[model samples]
Target chain A: MAKSFRDSLEAGFTITAEIPPPKSVSFPKSIEVAKKVAGKVAGLNVTDNQRGMMRMSSMAFSHILLGVGCDPVWQICCRDRNRLALQSDLLGASALGIKNVCVMTGDYPTLGDNPGAKAVYDLDAVQLMKLTDGFSNGKDIRGGVMKNHPDFFVGGVVNPFYEPIELELLKLQKKVNAGAKFFQTQPFFDIESVDTFLEQAKPSGAKMLIGVTPIKSMKMLKFLNENVLTKPIPDGVSKRIEFASDQMMEGLKISAEFINGIRDRVDGAHIMPINQVASLPLLLDMVEEGNGA
Target chain B: MVYNAPAMIITKKKDFEEILFAIGDTRSLFLLGCGDCATLCKTGGEPELKEMSQKLVAKGIAVTGTAVVPAACHELDTKRVLRKHKDEVDKAQAVLALICGAGVQSVGDNTDKPAYSGCDSLFIGNSKRQLHYYEKCSACGECVLNDTAGLCPETRCPKSLLNGPCGGAVGGKCEVNSENLCVWIDIYNRLKKAGKLENLLLKISAPKDNSGLAKPQKLELKREPGR
Candidate 1:
């Protein structure tokens, strides 16, 4: 039997990488990329209509990853479904033998190409986690018994850089209480904040994977710093990336250094290359070398 | 600060024609005003009540009496105020309540006379100046203010999104209403100011718990036997 991501985390440092579904119907490129990193990483997380843009459903793409001999972490966002639809999808995903799942409150629909689309946020991340937990326990959201329950290793996301760290910690506790077995955080630029957050959150007992997004270009770094991420990129890192002749190499080095710095503190790292899937293998190799894996 | 409770803020006064049409053949009327919400909203205050009385009299309708209660929604206070004006209330054909929906219902429950609302209740909000109010809560039953740096997306966002600066927001303004700040952006900025920006990124809030918001909500507190 293949080891679950949770088991990998418990055994030692785990590595998971995200593969965003393509906007088009074709999956050959995405599947090829998954096949490349299949054995190098513990699990591949397929993003769901990330940023509200329509793409191949995460569930379908995750199945494709499964066909390529990769364990897929299927992401389900609350932005597009009500309770009924969510429950149906959960059962369907499980029936297909997909075991790992990550629940999130997707980006608002207005942020997507279909700005006029109505968002169906019938449940938030916490509630969805609880609902998923219920499914694992052989019960539906309404407490009805199920003949076949999904055995999912459910995970959630956290941001260590969010302001009012105390409130964020409280929310993290709520997610834990709601049954989030693992957590993947937003990208970390400053190590100090991650340490502070870890010190406080360690007692919750949920496995955590710190997020690392390798910068592709100076413009990408600037855009992420100014608009995408709430945490401002540390000036030192930005200055390094800005001055580097090969920005991608600088970003990779920075990410590997960061992963090395916090490898002991966290269970793993979730590397998100966004649309730049080609760089994932190289980044993983750097991380493995730094970790002596 | 000991007892901070929700208050209703009215925005529009029913048109005179609408009110007269609602009164419908009721020649005599009794007026009730809310000293708290309606007074602040300028809809059912003492001055407005007196003005309404005059308007009714001009239309050849008899205004039997007028009384402004401390809070028209406070059933006990309204009951006491109505008892004091029992004779006038009993004489009128119908009662015109220039308060909110709750106040109108309170009057109806306490009086035998038909009760009609004269103002439309808009939202649970506050204002710094007269005739200008801002909606702050939708009473979603599930509050996520702690996660959003005390900004409410359920009411502030045109889409009532829990996770957002929906794509429609431009220049920090809402896509639906350019004059208003995009609540998610405001939340992001506030979280940034408080050094809690990571809260927005980390926490994926679930859908609002609307089950607790079923209408005619009632709450009863437990009390000690000898309290």
Candidate 2:
């Protein structure tokens, strides 16, 4: 059996990386990258039509990862599916032996390539997480008895960089109440904000993996800072990246620095490579070196 | 005046075929209209009610009576109006309310006769112009206008996202509507204009407190004896 992400967290500090599925049908390139990182990290998170752009299904990609003897964190976003569809997908994931699941209120459909597509957010993240919890306990969301239950180690997303950290903390508490076993936050740049979030959220007793996105270029850093609504890249960091002769090297250094800063404070680090999927091995090496392990 | 109580907006007029089918075999009808909302919407004003009465009479049905109340949603006012027209109301088999859903309920509460809605209650909004009105508030119960720079995502955004400008927004317009500005983007720009982008950065609104909006909401204040 594949080791559970929750168990990995309990054993010690864990590392998880996200691999957004390709937009095309062919998965040779993505599968190759997953195979390389599968042994380096505890698990990999397969994004579901991330940014509303149509990609191969996260569950299908996860099944592929499982075929290759890898543990996959199958992310289920609430944006695309209604309750019935979501419940059905959960059962399908469980039947395929996909153990780890992450629940997110997905990016709006307008953000994707198909801007005209209708969104089906019949359940928000909190409600969806609650439903998954029901499935694990042998009952459907309506309290109907189930002949077989799909046990999942459910996770949720949080934004430590979000302003008004108190509200985020309250949401974290609510997610915990709704059955989120672990949390993966938006990428963090300011260490003080992470410290403050940790101080307030410590009482919730939920393990959290701080997000660390490696800046691939100056434009990428600028886009994340300006366009991304949830996480903000600080001006000081952006200025540093702008001045660097080699932005990729600067970004890797910053990613490693962020991981090192929060390694002791957080339960784990979630690395999002964005478009630079090939850099996963190098990023992992830098993280290990930063941890001095 | 301290509270900005919601004002109803005019709704779509029910199709005549549907109404005839619903009233089924009833010859006489009592028609009710709202002078406020239905009048503004051109659905249930005195003119529309008179037109409907003429249409019903033309279709071989008796128009027992018709009254345009200032606000059909006001139960006590509707009750008094119905009492004044008790003879006509008693003669009718069913009362047709040409106002919003609340008005239909109000008319039903005021009379023993079966009340049928004549127009759909669209939303709470203000008159954009003489005959134009846009939906404004969804009454989500927990208001976040302070954090959103007065533009409401709950009512404006198709998704009602708390944290947003979800990736679909293109050219400052909503992905769903395309014609309307994405409320999240509007909120961000508005905050930036006010030089208080810190509000957007600092506050993370939780999943809306849906409990505060339990249906049929009631509020009571302790009395300070007789004035």
CA-lDDT, candidates in order: 0.81, 0.80
Query: Which candidate wins on lDDT?
Result: 1
Q: After superposition, how far is residue B148 of candidate 2 from its true place, in Å?
A: 17
Q: Which ten residues in a row have the lowest lDDT in candidate 1 chain A?
A: A161-170
- Candidate 1: which stretches are off by over 4 Å? A291-293, B1-128, B137-227
TM-score of chain A of each: 0.95, 0.93
**Which lDDT tens digits does candidate 2 get at residues A1-293?**
45657678888778899998887888687788777777778889999998888989999989988887678999999888877899999999999999889998887777679888888776777777878988998888768988779998988888665444444555677678778889887778878877877788898798888888889788897788666645567887888799999899788888887888777777998998888888888887787786423
User: What DockQ score does model 1 reach against the true complex?
Assistant: 0.12
lDDT of 2 by residue, B178-200 (tens): 78977766676677789876456
Fnat measured on candidate 2: 0.07
